[model samples]
Target: MPRLEEITPDNVSAAVDIKVGPEQEAFVAPVVTSLAEAYASRRTAWPRLVYDDDRAVAFVMGNFDPDNETEAFRCGIWRLNVDRAEQGKGYGRFAVLAFCEEARRRGHRRVTVLWEQGEGGPEAFYLRLGFRPTGEVLFGETVGELLL
Candidate 1:
């Protein structure tokens, strides 16, 4: 199973090097962009590098704000990307499970995610991971939630 490690000074460069294929560039931002957003939302975001054994294979950024009552979708995954070479190997699914576990550990009853609607989008993948549409649209993306 793949595990998540915080992007630290020692491994930030490797995490930044993680990428998806050209076709997926339109669906998800590069790791650098995700890192920048992490910084911008530092108060709630937890940016991580996904590792399988000793190799870095993916990048994930999530928000955990149990106190965010104003926004139902506040505590959720913000970004997720598995390097093209690592796709279809269950890494993304492992990462989602890990994120949900983390949210539950932090006392959250559920986790949520927002994704764009397109061919390469992760709507189906998230659904397979037990997430369901919340019927809430924000900024052109659909919101999905998974009760923990």
Candidate 2:
């Protein structure tokens, strides 16, 4: 079974090593960048590693700033990267559902996600998980929301 692990000194290297395929490169930022962003926004960013046994297979960052100026930033997934080899084993879904459950625990009623449109972007994956476009586009990325 897969489980979420908080980023720590011991597993930081493994988290940074997670990478997606070349086709998905343009859609998601690197885990290192997300880590840096998490540092800058430490109060609001909830970043974690998806581990299957002892192997870190993905990185997911959730933003939980209920008072953020932007609606999409209120309570949502800011970045998700499933390692190239670990794409289809349901790790991505597990991470997202985990985030949604976290959001609910935080008293949030919805979870948002942003996705760029491209050949191998994550729009379809988000949709498949019951996230529908919120009909708002920010910086050319479609805003998606899943009600919790």
Candidate 3:
């Protein structure tokens, strides 16, 4: 199973090397962008690089309300991406599970995700993971929630 690791100064460069397929470019932001936001956003964004053992395979960014209030949004996934060569190998699902576990550990009762509409988008994938649409939209993406 893949695991999430903190992006330290030593490994941050390697984390930025990870990339998703061109077709998925619209679905996720690059690691560099996510990391930059994480840095600028302070405690609100928790960014990590996903690894299959020692091999880096993906990047995931989780956003949360630092005060445990909905200042911006609840605890939820902000970004997820697997390298083009590593897609369809279940690393994405592994990252989701890790994110959910982390959310639960933080006392969140549920986690929400916003995804853009399109064929081959993550709506169905999130649904399969037990996320139900909340009939809400964020930044033009549908909001889906999973009870923790």
Give the best candidate by TM-score.
2
Q: How many clashing pairs per prediction, in order?
A: 0, 0, 0
TM-score-best of 2 and 3: 2
lDDT (10s digit) by residue, model 2, range 1-148: 8999999999999999998998789999999999999999899999999999999999999999999999999999999999999989999999999999999998999999999988889999999999999999999999999998
Candidate 3: give the clashing pairs.
Answer: none
Write down the TM-score of every candidate.
0.93, 0.99, 0.92
Candidate 2 residues lying further than 4 Å off, grouped into runs, are none
For residues 22-138, write the lDDT of model 3, one tens digit per residue. Answer: 777888888898988999997788888888888999888888785665522768899988888888898888888899899889888888888988976777778888989888877
The positional error of residue 71 in candidate 1, measured at the CA in angstroms, is: 2.7
Give the worst 10-residue stretch by lDDT in candidate 1: 65-74
Model 3 stretches astray by more than 4 angstroms: 66-72
Model 3's alpha-carbon lDDT is 0.84
Each prediction's RMSD over C-alphas, in Å, is: 1.3, 0.6, 1.7
**Residue 97 error for model 1, in Å?**
0.5
Q: Give the distance in Å from residue 143's predicted Cα in candidate 3 to where it truly belongs.
A: 0.3
- lDDT-based ranking: 2, 1, 3
